[model samples]
Target: MITSMREHKGHLYPGGISNKRIGVYELPDADISKYQRPWRAA
Candidate 1:
């Protein structure tokens, strides 16, 4: 029974696993434009 169990365990497939790298970037503050509008007279 022990030998049969070992053989069955060996036949089992491995689970999915990945070793990928990810990159993140941030924009500079000076490059951003300001959104300002003049006030209209009432």
Candidate 2:
């Protein structure tokens, strides 16, 4: 779910579920476009 959220920037915003449940696991502010590998696309 974390990967998927990061993929599309779908629903993983500040108030999203991941933030609610996993309070310590914040996503990094990465440049999604810089990822070249398929698995690292997001």
Candidate 3:
């Protein structure tokens, strides 16, 4: 359930969920390219 802000002209904006519920949620339609990796010491 990718929810977003619906403007007058039907504009959708991806947002975050506060106190995210387990049953209902929406995956933002955005770039999640960033990832977590172990730190490498030089």
Candidate 4:
């Protein structure tokens, strides 16, 4: 199992996940645009 999260437009958004048994994969990078929130540290 896998889980991840990201911030976009000042809201917490779900990030993508991939599972492969016979292939290679990479985790997606976090989105930076409009990710800054007033209640969280930068």
Candidate 5:
């Protein structure tokens, strides 16, 4: 997902499912464009 962040250039939200007995949690939205690293050679 990090690889796609550069192209998104917008807000990013987090979400995931938990086991039956567990509850879900909400995460703060991130403007991750500034945090994206430049593409590098492998």
Candidate 6:
């Protein structure tokens, strides 16, 4: 089984999962767009 994940717009979200055989099929790449959160000075 293959698990996928993606991060976009400052939040992380689950993309998808595949349970197919690895050798017979090509695996997809995970789409991810990570954002940096701003920190406030105390």
Best by TM-score: 6
Across 1-42, the per-residue lDDT of candidate 5 in tens digits comes to: 122212233434333343233222333464565766865658
Off by over 4 Å in 3: 1-21, 38-42
Q: lDDT of model 4 at residue 6? A: 52
Error in Å for residue 19 of model 2:
17
Best by lDDT: 4
TM-score per candidate: 0.19, 0.20, 0.18, 0.27, 0.20, 0.29
For candidate 2, lDDT tens digit of each residue in 1-42?
A: 443233433223323545444223334674566655565534
Candidate 1 segments exceeding 4 Å error: 1-19, 29-42
Better of 2 and 5 by TM-score: 2
Model 2: CA > 4 A from native: 1-30, 40-42
lDDT of 1 by residue, 1-42 (tens): 112111121132222234233223333443323424433557
* Model 3 lDDT per residue over 1-42, tens place: 544442222233444466353232344554334534533557
Q: Give, for candidate 6, the lowest lDDT window spanning 10 residues.
A: 19-28
Q: Who is ahead in TM-score, 1 or 4?
A: 4
lDDT of 6 by residue, 1-42 (tens): 436644444444444356433222223453333435544557
State the lDDT of candidate 4 residue by residue for 1-42, as single tens digits.
346655444345454356432222334564556545454656
Candidate 1 CA-lDDT value: 0.29
User: What stretches of model 6 exceed 4 Å from their correct place?
Assistant: 18-42
Q: What C-alpha root-mean-square deviation, in Å, does candidate 5 show against the real structure?
A: 9.7
In candidate 4, position 1 carries an lDDT of 39
The models' CA-based lDDT, in order, is 0.29, 0.41, 0.39, 0.47, 0.39, 0.42
User: Clashing residue pairs, candidate 4?
Assistant: none
